[model samples]
Target: MKIAVCGFVMGIANLIPGVSGSTIAVIMNIYERLLNAISAFAKLKPSKEDTTFLFYLGVGIVTAIFAGSLLVSLALKAIPVVTYALFLGLVLGSLSTIIKRVNKVKPTYIAAGV
Candidate 1:
């Protein structure tokens, strides 16, 4: 269920300009988990349980991307303003979560680049 939701979020994110699907995954707190699951595929003796879970998760993500992209494309063609507005709202909402997660910058950190 969680993976499906993340897939949906990622699918929508990819449809929006200036919004990265990877960034959405990061904001959703599943970035590392997703990466780890993909990396595990390279192992010689990969865990059977993990493989099975990843298989289903991958399917969900693929399905979401296919369905979401089609819906978004159609929505943009039929209602450009409303479609773009909804995407803007989603990006803004997700950005707030990302901003909160960022560490506060210290004077030294800022000065280092200058």
Candidate 2:
């Protein structure tokens, strides 16, 4: 159930531009386990636990993505301004976390990016 909820959150996060499901996984402290599970599948030797975990996570992610798409579509049609503002807020909120990962800053790089 917890894994499903985590997957659901990740799905919702992915609905937002610039938000990655892996970032959500890392925040939830399940990134390492997720990688292990994927690696197991890659080697075609997934354990029973990994199979079950992936099943639940996949279900949650797929369900949320479909449901979220509908809701977002409606919100965009009904209240486009509010919906856009909300997305913008989400992007800006993630910027602080992303900026923290930067070890160094170069003025030329920043200027070039801009």
Candidate 3:
């Protein structure tokens, strides 16, 4: 269920200009898993189970993207402000969540870089 919802959200993000579905996935906490799966495929000897799982997951994501793009494009054309407002809220909320997860006052880490 969670995957489905995230896929739908990514689908909607991809439909909007200036919004990246990959960015949305990153903000939503699914990017690492998705990237890992992709990287696994890049290996010469990927497991059959992993390959099958990725195949199904890819189908679900593609289906969601197709449906979301069609519906959102029509709705945005009819109500631009509302659609923009909703997307803005999503992005801002995601940003706040990301910030909250960050550690503050890492002077040692900063000094190591310098």
How accurate locally is residue 92 in candidate 2, as Cα lDDT from 0 to 100?
Answer: 73
Instruction: In candidate 2, list every pair of residues with a backbone clash.
Output: none
For residue 58, give model 2's deviation from the true position in Å.
Answer: 0.6
Best by the lDDT measure = 2
lDDT of 2 at 36: 98
Candidate 2 TM-score versus the reference = 0.80
- What TM-score would you give candidate 1 relative to the actual structure? 0.74
Candidate 2 residue lDDT tens string, 1-114: 999988998898888777788877877778888999999999999999999988888888998899998998899999999998998887777666655666876897568646
86 in model 1: Cα distance from truth in Å? 1.7
Candidates ranked by lDDT = 2, 1, 3
Q: Could you estimate the TM-score for every candidate?
A: 0.74, 0.80, 0.69
In candidate 1 the C-alpha lDDT for residue 29 amounts to 84
Candidate 3 C-alpha error for residue 100, in Å = 2.1
Q: Which ten residues in a row have the lowest lDDT in candidate 2?
A: 93-102
